[model samples]
Target chain A: MEGFETIIFEKKGQLALITLNRPRVLNIYNVRMRDELYEVLSAIESDSDVHVAIIRGAGEKAFCAGADLSEFLSAPAPTFARHVRWHRDVWGLFLNLPQPVIGALHGYVFGSGIEMAMCCDIRIASEDAVFGLPEVALGFIPAAGATQTVPRAVGPGHALDLLLTGRRVGAQEALAMRLVNRVVPRNDLQVEAEKLAEKIAGYDQGAVRKLKQAVSRGLDLPVGSHP
Target chain B: MNSIVKLECDRGLAVIRLEQDPPGPGLADRLAAICDELNYNTDIRAAVITGSGPVFCGDAATAHGAQAAFSLSTPVASLNCPVIAAINGDAIGIGLELALACDIRIAAGMAHFSLPEIEGGLIPFDGATQRLPRLVGRARAIELMLTGEVITADEALRIGLVSRVVPAEDVLNVALEMGREMAGKASWALRYCKEAVYKGLDRTLAQGLQLEGDLYFLLHTTEDRVEGVKSFKEKRKPEFKGK
Candidate 1:
């Protein structure tokens, strides 16, 4: 496994585990982390040896607290635009990837973290995880695909409520809201996610991939117009 | 400025209103026709669809006689350009479905949304069942569809139902602005990307990748790619012809 400066990208058997490496700032996304994430995702996407991928953050503080606010504040307009595009492209890779990506979330999954989790096929969170999109409160809307993807995950009303108010919800609330698939104790988050990933990986990858595509694409087609 | 359809164009943005007076009739058909026509016209890059008066759209079952209203799925899926729904007022049932079909939706501060089909003793036969879950999630989607509850714009925005909430007068304007922004991008890239993204959703990863590869190959053969590259090299904006 290649050593990553901003992320811990390791291969365990057939699973590629990518951990957001920052703990002090709650693993907030900075330029280096963002670029490294893109690189790691690209590696996984092209690596036939890796059958599945799991993303989590180091430490118990947060999976991510969203974008690094200091960095965002210092960026210029053109830089910001590029950052936005990069954000989209990276998440697009996750969403469009053929293999499954499971997000192991805990602590604060706010702002861009929520957006990133929304891109994953399945999300398993620790009972301690808290989720929200507090971007609006900061005077910016979710520019990363949250505006487009969150509704697809939760529904218009719930998605809008979170986006508009930037309110945070705990793991139980998240599960009840169906924002995440399952919630377990903080210590069991990784183990449970890996178990789920292994179960998915044991199946015919082709079928899993197809099922994902069918649900994602079929819903967008005309009603009763499935081909 | 006809009572059925009205068009306003400014700065390359097209605002198409679905207008009908009191007791409006057959408005869905007219709106569908307008969408089809606008899609076919190469000159128009982006469009905002809204109602002419207090209603963003009345119940499609009422104004279009239920059976006559166009299927929300087909027309919206076929449109090549970005479409924004400016929900200036109430968007209930089929009206809400129509709004969801658009790529982006902006609602007025006073806008209200609901899925009343189940409460009315009829399952939403259109794309609502499929789209609502995809737009929100299965749990919340079920809650809304099962209960037929009406949510206000504030609630809608909080939950990520609509992108923005503006004054009733500004909904159309904001939607139009968004349309123009989308139109300013590489048109062919946007079109192919949209097609690929939507199409890929229904396929297996391998199938989706193949589809993406084919579309990507097709795009690479177009003049827009060359222009896009050239403009990037020149550090200037690319003027795309949609080809």
Candidate 2:
């Protein structure tokens, strides 16, 4: 297995796990983490030994609280664009991965954190998980894919309800709304996510890949139509 | 809009085109009638849906006569076989809702999408309010409905709104390919999977799992399942009879 510095990368059987390690700052995504994430995702994508990927945070405080707001203050426009590109690339990795990517979410899953989780194929959140996109409150919008992915996962009215209100939603509500696939006790998040990953990994890889591609691709086509 | 629905079936694949020119108004009733016809027709295993003109569909209702437009939801819910949308052009408002109602949506490269119901001093009454959130998530769906901004096909694909984005002219071809592919799959399993997914959406996990188990038991008794296993053992293609 390939090693990561800012994030922990490990593999158990067919599962590849990526843990966001910056718990002291609640795993806020900064330039270093973003770069490292891109690297780790790319590595996992290329690793034939890996059948599934599990993403989670290192500590109990947060999965991620969005981009490092403090880092934004010092970055120039071009640099910011570069950072955005990097983030998008990482998200693309999660979205396009052949194997399923499951998000193990807990604590505060906000802003970019929610964006990241949305990119994954499946999301399993802890009971204490709090999800929101407070960018609008800061006079900024969710520049990440949140503007697109969030609405698609939920629905227009509910998506609007959350974006407009910027209120935090709990895990049970998130699952009820279909925002996340499952909600478990905080301590059971990893185990539950891992179990889901294991179930997915045990399936026919080609069939699963084709199904994911077909379903993902089918969403864009017209009803009864396929490209 | 009244002329949007057309039926074509070939080699077990069914093609349903949305040929209405926007503003798409009267198309809903026609779609409902077609849905009625399809319910009785047994030939098609998988179906493809697309637009007639450059635009896949526009708002279901125009400003002049609000009550004249048809509702896409009724026909959408009535569909039995898997429906895929080949969005060849812009899909907005009810157009977007129609796409949402389908099992899958494929868009043309030039396709643009939006839900402007919020800006029109009305909510997305044609299932957009409910379906969009189910497909995307609460935050992103709200942004589109509230802002009424159009997003490109690529953006739609990235966000999970639509499944695939193809060249404008290739929309139908791609949809046909998918229809054919699906038609080749185990018909009973496909139907059960579709039913389980949609029906289980609003149910609790236990209920959903119970439903899955029941359906799985039923599927195990099907001729197709036995043939599938036999075919696997023999390394041959299974000729499914859809029983």
Error of 1 at B228 (Å): 2.8
**TM agreement with the true structure for every prediction:** 0.58, 0.54
Poorest 10 consecutive residues by lDDT, candidate 1 chain B: B21-30
User: For model 2, how does the per-residue alpha-carbon lDDT over B1-243 read when each residue is reduced to its tens digit?
Assistant: 435567777866777777666634456677777777776766556677777877888775555335644688668766776677889899987888888887778799999999877675777778887788777766788899889889999899777788668999999888787678667656556555556556655554234434544554556455665565556446687677776
Which portions of model 2 show Cα errors greater than 4 Å?
Answer: A1-227, B1-4, B23-25, B63-65
Model 1 misplaced regions, further than 4 Å = A1-227, B9-12, B21-25, B62-73, B118-120
TM-score of chain B of each: 0.87, 0.93
Q: Pick the candidate with the highest lDDT.
A: 2
Q: Candidate 2, residues A1-227: lDDT per residue as tens digits?
A: 34555689888999999999989989888888888888888888888888889999988799998877666534454445544564456665767788788999999999889988988889999989999976533323454456556655775434544553356899977886679998889888888898899998999888888998887766655456434
Worst 10 residues of 2 chain A by lDDT: A135-144
Which tens-of-lDDT digit does each residue in A100-207 have in candidate 1? 889999999998899789878899999889998754333234545665566556654456446544568999778866789998999898899999889888988778
Please tell me what DockQ candidate 2 reaches. 0.03
